[model samples]
Target: MSYISRLGSAFSKSSMFASEFFLDLYMYAHYCGISPFQDRRNKTYYKLIIETHAIEKGLSLANPRMLFGRKKITEIMKAARRYGIGSNDLPILMATGALQDYLALHRSAGLSDPLLDSIDAFLKDRATASAVLGSGGLRHYPDGMPSPSPEKAALLTSRFSCRMFSPEPLDAETVKEIVRIAQTAPSQCNRQATKIHFYSNRERIGQLLALQAGSAGFAETVTGLVVVAFDLAAWGGAQQRNQGYVDASLFAMNLMLAAHAMGAASCPLNLAVPHSTERQIKIVGEIPKDQRLVMMIALGRPADGPLKSAASPRRTIDEILTIRDQAVAAA
Candidate 1:
């Protein structure tokens, strides 16, 4: 081609990228951060899940067959109710019902704990409680229940986000091994740009978690924090800007699964704070400005005993799937 033609083509490409970059920035402002109204339904939906998960976190400890943490459980239920009432969400109703049943069943089984009175009081508002706790709340198991089967399926299904970690320090080498396994996660264009900053120091983890906004009861107990970040330098243009988050998230999931496999528990800490919080996190975490934060995974040994995790129900495959093979023929 002629020199003038080549120069014109290059200019066209650069102009297109510049426009795309500004468009993405506009979207980031509106859709990405600290927006109160964005995805309100989903926001409250997960809030319900968080509150319900708090129960599982405590119940799944090594065996005592008795109720514990009355005040904490009551607080979790209260939070769930508040979020549920605000949203009037069906899934939240279902979860609340299941939790009520779980608590009721334990109380009936002579599991001695003072929380029964509180549970009864909460249930006294039968109208509100029954509205959410539809007919089938949850399944109950007598004292000794076996792990869910097909070992791999159990590994996937049984894994829970542990809130409480043992006070004992986690081994650094174990953390390294989990990350090594997680490194196998694929990245767009094989860029493999994900970086993890592991914080084993208690004070530093607390500082980072403070900026994180959540992690109230468990942050101090977290033996380690994995700050997952992806390098912007790995991508070329605006078209690939969001790919950093996508790739880093995949790596983060792998790291969590690897931690579970190695008998270490992990809780994913959301890093979706305001820009000011992000700036603070950058300083506390020592993350470079060029590296975008994905999320933090709180890792450590689970507190010893019968561990109870939230049986966060999964929607059936059909609920989420859409088959469109016939549409191609019509088009």
Candidate 2:
């Protein structure tokens, strides 16, 4: 090849790469929760959740300031009203619970602050919202951590993406147990932002599976659908933008494992759709607008007789691992 031809080809490749990188940035700018071009309703709800969680974190602190988060509480109230957050929304309920605990603690200590009076007034106006005060506040843990289990490897390797299922509907108690196990998945800063929505209705499962598009062959066998999502409000700053997906993915993996442990079959379904299709999914699935969908899970009891799954192999340790010790002793 001539030198000029080679140079021309290199320039063309570099230009194409640059264009693709900029396209990624453009998508991030428009779709991220912090973006101004994003939906206003979602943004407002995200702000409310973020502020509410801030209060929860403050309460959980080892040494929290008595009057800390006064500004945050004010912002929470503003966002709640701006977005018309329902009284029963978990974030609103938790915010009210945190405020109530704050008020009770300060008053019992004989402390005086104008912020307390404002909180008192706010709580009085929304008295109905205080129903969940017991559900959200911090709890005392007299006992320490539980011991680790010995069946880790057996449980992990035995689980697979189950495609065939029995027609029997999964009971409500089993679904709850699976979620309870999955909730133990760790998150950044103990935020616990993952949310699971389970649909046991056959018709609804079919509707959701239609949008997922990956469950075509086995859709008829699916008796339950699980939507795993993470609240975007639990994150802040540009650096933490993608953390929600990471946290939710961890939760989803745990959920699949939990299903397997409980003798229920589960297959992880991908939600790699456009923004418009995601909106449609949220509407059909009745998921909150501020939560980003991580993936869907098709759940059911395993069908009788021999079950079959693809032999999805893993790379050997050497193929997947890299070791750098002291930079090879400066060889």
TM-score for each model: 0.69, 0.55
lDDT of 1 by residue, 6-94 (tens): 99988988988999988976787776534674686565556555556555544443342356555556765675566653333545554
Model 2 lDDT tens row, 8-46: 988887777677667779999989889989999778756
Model 2 regions more than 4 Å off:
1-152, 326-331
Model 1 spans with C-alpha error above 4 angstroms: 1-90, 98-150, 326-331
Give the range where candidate 2 is weakest over 10 consecutive residues by summed lDDT.
139-148
Write down the lDDT of every candidate, Cα atoms only. 0.71, 0.75
